[model samples]
Target chain A: MSDVSSLEAEVAKLIVRTLTLKVDPAQIQPEEPLFGDGLGLDSIDALELSLAISQFYGHQIRSDDPDTVATFASLRSLCQSIEKHRTK
Target chain B: MTVGWLRQRERGSRIASRFMIWMALFVGRPATRALLYPICVYYLIFSKQACRAIRPYLIRALGGPISRRDLYRQYHCFASTLLDRVYLLAGQGNRFDIDIRGLDVLKDRVARGQGCILLGSHLGSFEIVRAIGLTQQDIEIKVLMYEQHTPMIRDLFRDLNPAVADAVIRTGSPNSMLRVKECLDRGGVVGILADRLLKQDQATACTFFGKLARFPAGTMWLASILKVPVILFFGLYRGGNRYEVHFELFAEEVTIDRRHRDREVQRWTQRYADRLEHHCRLAADNWFNFYDFWEEQR
Candidate 1:
């Protein structure tokens, strides 16, 4: 599997857990947009994601920046940002 | 309706009502989904007289057309919101999008360590702001809050998300004020939700929604005295978990002159108000003030 594909599998799990999404984890494509026309998450989910990232891996994900849309643009990209900011 | 009879009845009923509210919060049960309903039904069933007495106040405060069904729904929604808040508070997760803009503005002021005031409003699930200190912003936040009426719910909130919970400074207490001053003196930030009116001699008339409405002047007073840079923020909730946390420097800088103090605050407060309203209009449903808003105009 490509590095990006593997990254998305993990993020899909997070999406399932955090937002209570019902999709199969493997079905979440790496490049699929998480916010729009996809998993159907919103601002509260963003806050929950912020809390999740901060607590689990000690990384801070900010939603106020445009990067948020980009990072969360695809599961793979979000993982990359998480990998970059992972405190532990 | 003897005065003595009414007073005794009031005291007796308050004690009983408080007990049930406490039970719902602390002890979750099978009928938990009906928590708010049971209480409202209790009131309607037992306290028919009180329901009739307070119906007008409820209609006016809620700014809604009155019907028993609608009122019940409103009351029930309020209860559901309270319950959901409690449940979320119990389990705060990690991995959030705490996007920031103009953070440098807040950072520079906090760097001065003069204990800045982080004025916020209830446009978004600002409970999300608890993620601040735990994330990019290193400032310790002390929030001033009016304790929720129910003690059981209050305790639940106290444990929701420790990052934010630990930072809260309850309002109307000297400790809360001292903590604000202490954070300021240490060059930290104090978060205060200033949009809502106070229960007492606390608010001043300010223009909102194109008319005069009550708003607290405390943000101005705090800014003038502590006189730190007041940063205004609004986490405009667009939908789901999507929020735009727009930040601004309410004032580039402030002066300590007593003469210009009130107008200075009004000027800056107006700016903050303007920004807040702009975002609020962006997502009316997410604005989330189910209770009375613009009480004076309405």
Candidate 2:
């Protein structure tokens, strides 16, 4: 797998575990959404997932970030941003 | 999958509110309260959406079949609070006898200069809490509100009291969380209504009143992340100018272990739902969300 794909899978696992999402981590499509009308994750999940990401990678996901919409758009997009920003 | 209550257009007009405010100051409360009967009758007859929404709540709360009289009672109770809000915000709040239960919780938190979350619901007038804060100036309060959602009511209240309006932290702004954190850092109590789902993103399905319903998790998550105490508050309308404000210390601090964050959120959210249910049962007529609460598909 490409580095981006592996990153997406890693983040997908994080999302599933943090949110306790019903779907399997392997089943989360790389291009699938993580928010409204998509994976159906809510704001609580967003906060929880952000904390997990911060703990794992030392990168805090700022809710007030200007590009928050695109940052949380999909598994692939989120992982790309995470890869760019992750401190660890 | 119907339109949520928060999305519904406010039924009262600005002109009517202005007129009522003038009438409240001039005619006084007793005469003005008499006016509520006809107004409530009008809502009971005309506001189909509100009527339909309130029925299930009344049925569950009353523990039996509901009558037109019961519906009218709920409307009248709401109207009474609305009229009182005009007086409350107008700085004539001393006119009513408000019994505040569990005030020590607030006093202790503020005394320690520790910021906390005052989580309230739609059951009664949050204005009562503001009224309490107004009287006790030492306890600073800030409310998180969606200023644009209810323009008519928001504008009316703002016109009534500019000081209160200035204290509002408008939701959805990029710096919204920043403002909240700043206020908390200063040991100011930040108030948020956690019962209703304002948007699809803010909602989480939780069991309420023996059925699954969507409740907002923003307040709980924010409190947990900030490591602030969560205090459940209710300003229940007790009919005819009598309001009771109850404060229960919900959590000293919300601690979410990374391994169990989702479960922790659900647990906290359900605890709030449980408290809200208790208060709703205590003051059935005061439960005032005028749209189908259980409308969301779980």
Q: Find the candidate with the highest TM-score and give its number.
A: 2
Q: Summarize candidate 1's per-residue lDDT along B1-298 as a digit string, tens digits.
A: 1111122132124454445445545775335654566776664566554445435434543456567764554445444434444433544223334466676777666666556677788656555554445334566767777654334444545544555566666664322454566566676777778776645324556666565656666667556645567778766544322445666877655554545655665665676667766665554334434333554222
Interface RMSD of 1: 15.8
Q: How much native contact recovery, as a fraction, does model 1 achieve?
A: 0.00
Q: Which stretches of candidate 1 lie over 4 Å from their true place?
A: A1-88, B1-99, B111-114, B132-138, B148-150, B159-166, B260-264, B296-298
- TM-score to native of every candidate shown: 0.52, 0.78
Evaluated with DockQ, which candidate comes out highest?
Answer: 2
Look at candidate 1 and tell me the lDDT of residue B58.
46
Per-residue lDDT tens digits for candidate 1, residues A1-88, read 4444555576678778865667888777776767647765543355456567667778866533456556766677778888888996
Q: How far in Å is the alpha carbon of B65 misplaced in model 1?
A: 13
Residue B45 displacement in candidate 2 (angstroms): 0.5
Model 1: how far is B211 from its true place, Å?
0.7
Misplaced by over 4 Å in model 2 are A1-88, B1-3, B133-135, B296-298
Question: CA lDDT of B56 in candidate 2?
Answer: 80
lDDT of 2 by residue, B47-93 (tens): 88789877888888899999999999999988898899888888888
The true-versus-predicted C-alpha distance at residue B136 of model 2, in Å, is 2.4
